[model samples]
Target: MNQNKRFCLALDLKDDPALIKKYKEYHWSGQAWPEITDSIKSAGISDMQIYCTGNRLFMIMEVDETFDPKKKAEMDVNNPKVQEWERLMDQFQIPLPWAEDGQKWVPMDKIFQLA
Candidate 1:
């Protein structure tokens, strides 16, 4: 049996409403580039979802037990399509003030969970 792990991360969109709109449009159902989605799944991520409130963005990512974030990052660094997508998306993204150097999405600590 394969077990999956869930990780929650947070990011911020450029404060401009126009940029936010474009960001959401890019992520709309079936709107993401095939290469990007393929890379995500191939990285062992089973599912991912992003939600936004105001300028804040939250992501819920589910991945298999063998998923290694460092490995995924290394893969992304070598993938031209992923790099291209990142560059394009960077225009609408503002890394969290508290994010580490070169980090886009900041991982959120799970503080509470009923289940």
Candidate 2:
């Protein structure tokens, strides 16, 4: 594996199967909007992968040493295309019951890692 830092996050898909299918479709390689990919790259995110099972979704992000979540969040706020993509995605996503207000992807605690 690469030396980049990895963060894992979890969220839920709206319990509707159809919406979940559409969400998967939107994530297909060529289906994602170019602006969305560009924004992520510009934010210093080296790589990102999302997986789904039932109604649960997991995201694994690999970020470079220069990546700052706070800075990325601020940049995303000022990017209109990023906002539009987020709004579209919100239709298929739901925060976990324990998630704080305004939180979407809840960070996961890493319990163990082998050296």
- The segments of candidate 2 whose C-alpha lies over 4 angstroms from its true place after superposition are 1-3
Per-residue accuracy of model 2 over 1-115 as CA lDDT, tens digit each: 5668999999999999999999999999879999999999999899999999999999999999889999999999999999999999999999999999999999999999898
Residue lDDT tens for model 1, 1-115: 7599999999999999999999999999999999999999999999999999999999999999768999999999999999999999999999999999999999999999899
TM-score of every prediction relative to native: 0.96, 0.95
Against the reference, the lDDT scores of all candidates come to: 0.95, 0.95
TM-score of candidate 1 against the unseen true structure: 0.96
Instruction: For model 1, state the Cα shift of residue 107 in Å.
Output: 0.4
Per-structure clash totals for the candidates = 0, 0
**Sliding window of 10 residues with minimal summed lDDT for model 2:** 1-10
